[model samples]
Target: MIKFNTKTNQRSDYLPAASYSLVKQINSRGVYSFCMCPGGVIAPCATKNNEIVTNGWSPSQRNYPTANSGIVIELKVDDFKKYSSFGPLAGVEFQKNIEQKAYKLSNDSQRAPAQKLLDFMNNKLSRNIPKTSYIPGTVFY
Candidate 1:
């Protein structure tokens, strides 16, 4: 991102550069009319907390049925405002590493370590399986 310090951080206030009308509505009017801005337009976007933050939407228009929705990656201060010593790219680096880790962890290769009831019964626990990351209650290991 362009690293905004404030709404007035003024990379010019209006994107698309050539357009000033949007800037007039947003900056001059002071009423940020974000169109159906995701979920709440603004939620607790916490990247440092190892949370998969997100939001969603459904329209009231013809193709819009009011419905439910769904929702990454690690990000640290060092990788953001610190490491790489490159300002915003630090955050990019952090996200890259987190994505890599997530991909590696999720590579089940169509054969996760699940066992049938008979197999589970036949085996005794000599090593501990990891705690499942699934929500609700994870199955017993």
Candidate 2:
């Protein structure tokens, strides 16, 4: 999930809601925006204990400062082949594993691991996180 800086021109206060899809390279995986929520919050949507999943949603007024969305990559069946031992549920198992990993990484709590966009691209941890809509809070990781 990504949150736009409302302090800037990217704020949802003026821009209309939008979504995007892009392929960075030929024959490579495509990334697309999902659940684009203008002036929305990042919700914890985990369905099981010891796991972490996220979704996005906007309030009725869509008046929050930041906009957020799920920037998802197109996944193929082959991506879960490593978990084929799970049979027909390989994909589910794969997703579960990821969620569990996130849970573990965040010290086994509801707090989500997060970092600033620029810091992430620079392969470094953020010194501090700005205000966000995620209510359970965040831990830089």
Best by TM-score: 2
lDDT of 2 at 103: 96
Residue 127 lDDT in candidate 2: 83
Question: Which pairs clash in model 2?
Answer: none
Which sections of candidate 1 miss by over 4 Å?
1-82, 85-88, 108-141
lDDT of each: 0.32, 0.77
lDDT of 2 by residue, 13-65 (tens): 44456645543432477755476667788989999999998788888767776
- Best candidate according to lDDT: 2
Q: Give per-residue CA lDDT, model 1, range 17-44, as digits (tens).
A: 1211221232223322133321122222
Give candidate 2's error at residue 75 in angstroms.
Answer: 2.5
